[model samples]
Target: MLTERFRFLLNRFRDRLWVKPLAVCLLSIAVAFVAKFADGTGMAKFTPQISLDSIEALLSIMASSMLVIATFSVSSMVSAYASAANTATPRSFILVVSDDASQNALSTFVGAFIFSIVAITAVKNEYFEKAGLFILFVLTVFIFGLVVVTFVRWVDRIARLGRMGTTIEKVEHATAAALRRRLNAPNLCGVPVRSNLEGLAVYAANVGYVQYIDMAALQIWAEQSKVRVVVAALPGSFAAPNNILAYVIADSAERTDIDSTAVALAFQIGGARLFDDDPRFGLVVLSEIAGRALSPAVNDPGTAICVVGTLVRLFTLWSEPEPVGGKQAPKYDRVEVPELSARDMFDDAFTAIARDGAGVVEVAVRLQKALGALAASGNADLREAAEYHSRLAFKRSQNALSISEDLEAVAKAGNFKTKHAESVSSSDGKQQ
Candidate 1:
């Protein structure tokens, strides 16, 4: 099985771009060998009395040049392939199979070996009179090749680092914006209008009051009144304006109360409640409602002002306060949570399975911890909001555990079943 696996891997590798460099190296060797044989056998040797020693020396030089080129090509190809593969696939597999430093060193050694052979052959052929000159030439080639390789690798590293920094900045900005929106409860005035009912739902959820508004009541109201009471917004959501998010029965007697209540409910839940009837009053009412809810916690107009001030500060800084509230009043600090790419997450699960064996308690525990942290810090409310998200996380973890066990079972079964069948077939054939 191992031999077959190795053969499969070798075939796959031979199809990669680096294989071209390997082919070139082999071709160079073959050409040099054929030329030497042709000259020896008097097969159209159109040379001006080329000596055997001189011919050998030229072959050595060509071989050295080919080796250097091959080494550089292999190093570049391996680095590019590994980086690209890591981006697309799992880092765990890449870590298991290859590393940048080792690949680089191997390439350099191969090139150095070829250079050494050339140096020895050149010295033997008396290409230079002084031994020092030969030594200098060898040293020069080695140093030059090493420097060039190192520089390329360094540039590649820097470029990757730059990309990582930019990604981190973007994540920080998004997190900060989200935190600010949550904290400040900014009045959505002159904002591009989107769906109002959806906006109301989100606002309700964010302010920990969405459950108060009966969904059934709203639905009943919509049907009885012959008005489309569309939810322009949901709880924990954002919107922009002239966007008719919700439409209600504008002609009904209860229309005034329904729209008023809807806007009032939306304002109560950290949303800007603006209407054609009274836009500024809507803003004042929303502010008063949010302030009254938060006032219990901070208990002062100054503190309320501070909370609003914090939102602006967070927005400008593009950051949030750390979980561990520090002294000197919690200041916003940029946070960069490493985004677990699909490959990274898969690799984490793979590594856990491979090292700890299947059905391990640790895997479940780790996953639980991860989910818990996400719940605690990820703008999620366990009591009145985010029940759906919590349930989804639980289901996902359960599924992952099940999948891990299945994979383990399959791996344990292996190709032994195939071998056993083959053995039975042979035994029957012999009996016949």
Candidate 2:
């Protein structure tokens, strides 16, 4: 029964677009006349001679005020309604957050008292003395209120459309696999590639705030390589490199395209951040190998790869292997985990990369040194296992390096080709 009632209400609201405006108009008219009547006799004791001119002036003023007030009120109401209707989450009522209930009540009381006092003063001042004018004032107020209500509703509709227009713009400019592919051609900067892929494709892309890129290119690359690509976080959202932004299937060819797209996208987005001199930009690449170990929902073969990818990336970033003598020691102590922002992690990685030039050989050498030190210090039996795991890490690092190299090659080639072509065209013009 409740469901049926709700359905009915929704249908009614949908059908009667003018219901709110009409109701506001009626309420405004009632308030204007009631206030006038109450003040004329109950509050104000003075009575004056009625005159046509006085009636006309009073009616015009009251009508104009009523119309302006009603228009603003109805506009606010319509905007609130539209916002509530379009939100994904359930709308909560406006709750008073303050704990001072007494103060709030006192304020309300004082406001009402002041309004009454003002109304009485207006009456005593003989603002509504003409009887013929009173009738005209009431009629004029009603008509103006109606006009205000209608105008307000129109404004609300326009506002809602404006909000939708912004959302559409974001989606259009959002980073997708397909978009990455289109922008992949040789350019001044280098070949574009994607980096740090993780997460399912559920949320909308946020633009301008943070990680904004063309997702269409990535999607195209994914399709060509037969990899499933999915984006997770909304655009403008602050995220760490290890944060799962999207998930990609790791079919070899698809993986290559996916990695390429991811790397390109990272460079584009991160470079943009650098250009803007925003210190919060960073990227983290997750290996799909780890994605294969999680539960089906958490690791949905198709769209859930990023969940596992994120886990792997975090593990690589923070975990320390236990001593070799211990029972396959835990990589990380739960208690020691600190809440670190993406910017912090990226900063650390950036510093490391800068010290070592971000070359594949340099990164691998560093990782090996770090791993070797841990192994020798009774941290784990990684020496024997280091070769296996290090190789995997090397592979991941190599992919990143390849993307960077490809981007550079494309950039250099494009520059050389453009310069040569320009020179040739100039020579031809000179000969002519």
Candidate 3:
């Protein structure tokens, strides 16, 4: 559990600009010390024959040029992020900003630059003896090699980083991973969370999204107080003053205020919802992107179609059976939380696309086919949701299209169970 906590903290820190560069600089300095001690310790004999002055010149050039390059890289990334926000959905900007590859590449470049500056300063100070000099020279060459590799990789990644298709793929991957995590530990591996509770309702003190719920702490308090706790709001849910954040259920004889504050502290309320615990947010973002693409100014029906395919992939994944057998018992069995609804996810994924792209015959046809395919996924809830959206999209297409042929095409593709009866009624009205 401590390991998991440490892992969570490390992951949270890893995406930041300072963490990796600081780590790389410290490690480089540690190597410099190793080189200092190993200078005349038969290590220099095995080291390369590069001269100190040559190494210092290279380091100086790298230090100056790399600072410029790093600044330019940051600027380019900022431009790309702005473009992505404008072209794609702004909700996905966080993922682009926190890109692991981009962060790593930038860190490597900046870290190498810092190492160069420090090495150059040390060399000018005559801190390194000839043997130590040879070691630093070798490390400098290694750093150069690292810089070249990182630059090549960064170039490739930056070219595609903020493109609409690439961003969609990135969001989809993040969403799928989040969904898998939820699939494994729905309700945070606790009993099913319920909305109803007879216990004392604990309201939030702030207005924000419930970013994370620390079930471990809740279970601890529940265990200590000899009561069952029911979470009223899960992660991604908005919380407000006097809103029930959770319900504290205690025995009739027990006092209520014992650990209520501590329990409240466990919920990590934040300004925005996180993508990790909120699959619905991901779906909404994808739908928003599709809606943007379908706008008259954009008119990119292909993107909407791609998003439809992605949604189908997501729902198919959702339909898979969750893996069985955890190594330990459920961590917070006494805490009850609600399961995510397939219906909500579907609406988030499709409703906007259907409404916005309704006029485009190609988009409408693809939407029908995509929904029909999802309806065949063998999950009853998914089928029902898909059919419902299909009918709504069909009706929207009917209203948006002025041409009779386009309307008929979308109606034909609807594939609703009542299609025959509707067609018959329409024929009767036309004949009258």
Candidate 4:
């Protein structure tokens, strides 16, 4: 439970551009003094003596060059982030910013710069003996090589970082991971709540979206209070001071013993939704990107079509018989979590695209085909939702498309999805 909370915090902080760089800079400063400490080992007598001037000159060059590179790295990343937010969706900004290669590149440059400055200053003050200077020189050379390699690798990535296709790919991967995690913990490893919980309500303290649910904490509280903890708002659900996050169903008529404050803390609230645990958020963001592309200003039907294909792939993941690695058995026995609704997911993924791209024949046709694939999925819930969306998209297109041929085209695709769904259901029935 603590690990999950810590992981959410870690991921949240890691996305910030400065965290890694700041950490690396501090480590570099510490490393700068490593040689001085080693000089006390009496091993200096066996080391080769090197001139301090060469080391100082090398350090000076690195110190100057690294600062420039670090600044440039930040500038480029900022531009890429802005581009991703504008071209794709603001929600995708974090994924682009959290690119491992980009962060590593920025951290390496800043770390090298800090190391050089500390080393050069110490050398000028005669802080290191001859052996220490030689050791620092070796370290400097290693750091320099690292900088060069990182720069080379980062150059390739920065070029493609914020492009529409790149951002879409990043969002798709995030969505898929979230979907997989959902598969593994459909009920947050808690018992499934089948009916309305009759209990004392624990209201959220904040006005924001539900981010993380500490199920373990809820279970602990439930055990202590001799009550059942029924989660009312899952991750991605909106939270308000007046909204109940969870209901504590206790046998006792007086529920004064239950710590309502502690129960409320289990539901982590944030200013906006996150993709880490909220698969629906990811789907919504993907739809937003497609919706933006379909806007009159962008008028990019191809991008919308691309998004349709991506959505199809993402939705199919939910139909997998088992999670990729295997699912962990439910652990929070006393805590009950509602099932993630398949209908909600379909709504998040397709509603915006169908609404915004209704007039674009190409986009509407692509959407229909994508829904068709889902309509035939083995998962009955997915098939049902897909068929629903297919009909919805077709109806919307029929209203928006003025041309007879365009309307007929979308209708044909929707008909195909319905027929295919029936055939699949019949086949399954025959096999049974």
**Most TM-score-accurate candidate:** 4
Cα lDDT over the full model 2: 0.34
Count clashing residue pairs in model 4: 0
Q: Which pairs clash in the backbone of model 4?
A: none
Which stretch of 10 consecutive residues in model 1 shows the poorest summed lDDT? Answer: 330-339
List candidate 4 stretches off by more than 4 Å: 41-46, 252-257, 416-432
Winner on lDDT (2 vs 4): 4
How many clashing residue pairs, candidate 3? 3
Tens digit of per-residue lDDT, candidate 1, span 1-432:
143235435534633444433454454334222323332343343334434454345445645665665566456545554543332222112221233443444444454445445544554655533333333343544545664675567446534421322222322333353333323322111112232332222122243221112233444454554444444433322343323323443444443444434433322232432111121222222233224323334333332232223322332331233322322221111100111122222232223222222233333233233333333443323211222322432333434444443323332232223543554466568779
- Which of candidates 1 and 4 is the stronger one according to lDDT? 4
**Cα-based RMSD of candidate 4:** 6.0
TM-score of candidate 2 against the unseen true structure: 0.21
Tell me the whole-model lDDT of each prediction, alpha carbons only.
Answer: 0.35, 0.34, 0.81, 0.89
lDDT of 3 by residue, 314-394 (tens): 888888755444323467777887878888888889999889989999999889988988888878988899889988898
* TM-score for all models, in order of appearance: 0.25, 0.21, 0.92, 0.93
In candidate 1, clashing pairs total 30
- How well is each residue in 1-432 modelled by candidate 4, as lDDT tens digits? 677779889999978888999999999999999988777888688889889889988999999999999999999999999999999999999899899999999999999999999899999999999778878988999999999999999999999999999999999999898888889988988988964677888898999999999888888887887888889999999999898898888857676677678888888898988989999998999999999999999999999999989998898888998886788798998888998899999999999999999999999988988898898989999999998998888778867887666766777777754644454466568779
